[model samples]
Target: MLRLSQFIFKETRERLGTLSFLINSIKFVTLAVFRILKGLFMNGTKVFNKEKIMQQNNTYVLIMAGGVGSRFWPKSRNHFPKQFIDILGTGQSLLQMTYARFLQICPKENIYILSNQDYKGLVMAQLDGIAASNILLEPSRNNTAPCIAYATYKILQQNPEANIVVAPSDHLILKETAFLDKITQALEYTSKNEALLTLGISPTRPDTGYGYIHFEQEAVAGVHEVNRFMEKPVLKKAKEYLASGDYLWNAGIFIWSAKSIQKAFQTHAPEIAKLFEQGNSVYNTSEELGFIQENYPNSPNISIDYAILEKATNVFTIPADIGWSDLGTWASLHEVLPKDASNNSKSTDHLHLEATSNCIIHLPSGKAAVIKGLDDFIIVDDEKVLLIYPKSSEQEIKSVAGAMVATYGKEYL
Candidate 1:
């Protein structure tokens, strides 16, 4: 009986030892995995914190929203331009979208809208979150140079070491992530260098509406030196540009340090620069408006492209593949929107009786529109004015809008 009992005790001790070994093995593996995952998580958090600091410290956006969008005729007007309206059926206006895109890369307080004084109310109403002071209003439409000068001087007064991105308020970027990434990279590049950088879109077709930028094929740290800037070219020149493999569509988006641009203006456009520099004392104060009104007209009515970019020797180009469109015309808007099986795009549902091939219509929802046997046409109904025009003759819209305004008064416009 004693021997049997001893044998049982020995077997039990052996089984307990095996269980202890199994538990220790599992505990060791789990601890190793947890440490590895914890290290990865901490590293990722460190990277994110660094990026956040980089954006907050050095980034500011200057959105130019002062244009009278005549090309968008019945939909866009002088009082309420395309930037304030939802040109896309996406429920957000172009200005709002542009604002939102920058929020991902910078603080909301850092974004400023440079718009006409007439549209101040519209800008305030659309972007309620922005400070009224941040909406830099122009007394009259002198052009981009004055607009940029005012914003730059004001921003410089606030933060001397600011890196600014000047972008049009009405452009559409289909790939928002890639757009922000490129802009982030640009801000980083401009922060450290005295170079002036502009985002250039790779040309997908021979588009005559856009200006062209010829760049050196060799790139320095992912940026190319600008060979030359060409105005909107004729069809033959545009086609040649497409074939050259060295040109990109100028996106009208620019990035530079506030100090760099201020210096450029001092060197190349000293007259305009001096006008704003004199207002340095009143820049971020209550006397700014009076100063701007007194001095804005003295500056030349020239675009920033002609004013500073063309003359600056340190200009560089970052060729970006982000899907972009200015959406200057109805035809361009149609290209971005989704079409039905019949290749007809519309903002509202409408009946199609044998209507086929590349037609766009904009009408209020529940409004009845019957389109038949039309191809490559544009139909817009804004309740007061209805425009049924051919897409091929879209360029005539500016003249047509002017004529209508002249004949029917500004109410129709």
Candidate 2:
């Protein structure tokens, strides 16, 4: 009886030990699975948060290159505008260079070209690497205001939170790094503040060719609150502006969010804004051409400066010393181009004799050009015709081209 009782006790002890071992193994596997799942979930959350942050920083740049550049005539014709020419001998067209500069700040898909419908092929050929859908073509030449409004509406449709930098395609910027830095700063400010921002170039001369921005006080670091906009004042007024040190050359570069610009249009130019709103449905579609052709001509021919900036209360200016030139006329081109020892600016192929002071000779092609006993003159050869005018009369070149187009056929233009 004693032996049988001992055997039963030993068997019960063995069964209990086996049960304890099975419970321990199950607990270990459950804990391991929970830890692995937690780790995977945390990593996925981190990656998703990073991607969202990157997307919020995205920006768009709209380049206005639609004008015919009638001022740079003889060389700059209707079919081939100044923006498509290699005026700086940099082996890249103006549009190409402008697009490349913005690529450093924004993605290629975010860059847009608002140009004439006629120059669509030229723009595409020059900027072939950019996506074809990004280019916005105008069916007619209404002016800057309509062009900007259309672009703003289209951009807002794509990205409601988009910030845009609108720039001209033909201007020459020497200090690219400084220019880009200034643009980035302006974008940051505009995104945060509800203001219309324009980059004003530091005035180096009392020239009457460009517009001026009058500031009452410095708003921020290197930025000023614009008091008023003065357009091409007289020589006396220009000197006074220079002496007062409260003015800057309007560089015509603007940075603002899509919402801000759209609001400005709605407030200042309601008719044009309505046109754009009605035409927005056709954007990025084959019907864009037909819609613009039908609706664009009825819009106003006002500039953004005249339509909104001049009247806006929240206008601000960033006075940038970013080495800028509009290249508006022959004299301005001479100012930016390198001069020889005799203080004369000559193109790739030119011969000068006894030309000691202040002259600009530009032959578009590398054809031999010869000049003698001339000073302060602009000589431009466009293969079909040549222009010889005084550098002092540079502002009259556009009027001269218009008169020629009227008198002769478009062949001479």
Give me the displacement of residue 237 in model 1, in angstroms. 1.9
For every model shown, what is its TM-score relative to the native structure?
Answer: 0.86, 0.84
Candidate with maximal lDDT: 1
Q: Given candidate 2, what's the lDDT at residue 180?
A: 76
Candidate 2's C-alpha runs over 4 A off are 1-57, 285-287, 349-352
What does candidate 2 score on TM?
A: 0.84
**Tens-digit lDDT track of model 2 for 219-331:** 67556788999999999999999999999999889998899989988998899889999967777788877887788888888888899999888889888876678888877
**Candidate 2's error at 381, in angstroms?**
1.1
Q: What is the lDDT of residue 95 in candidate 2?
A: 88
lDDT of 1 by residue, 1-413 (tens): 22332343344447657666334332233233333333433442212233653545778899999998889989897778899987776667899989987777778788899998899899988996789888898887889998898899999999999999999999987656567767877777898899899999999999999999999999977899998899999999999999998999999999999999999999999999889999999988889989988888788999998999999899999998777899988999887664555667677644554746688788876687667788998889888889989999999999998898899998767
- Residue 333, model 2, lDDT: 79
User: Could you tell me which 10 consecutive residues in candidate 1 have the lowest summed lDDT?
Assistant: 41-50
What lDDT score is found at residue 247 in candidate 1?
A: 98
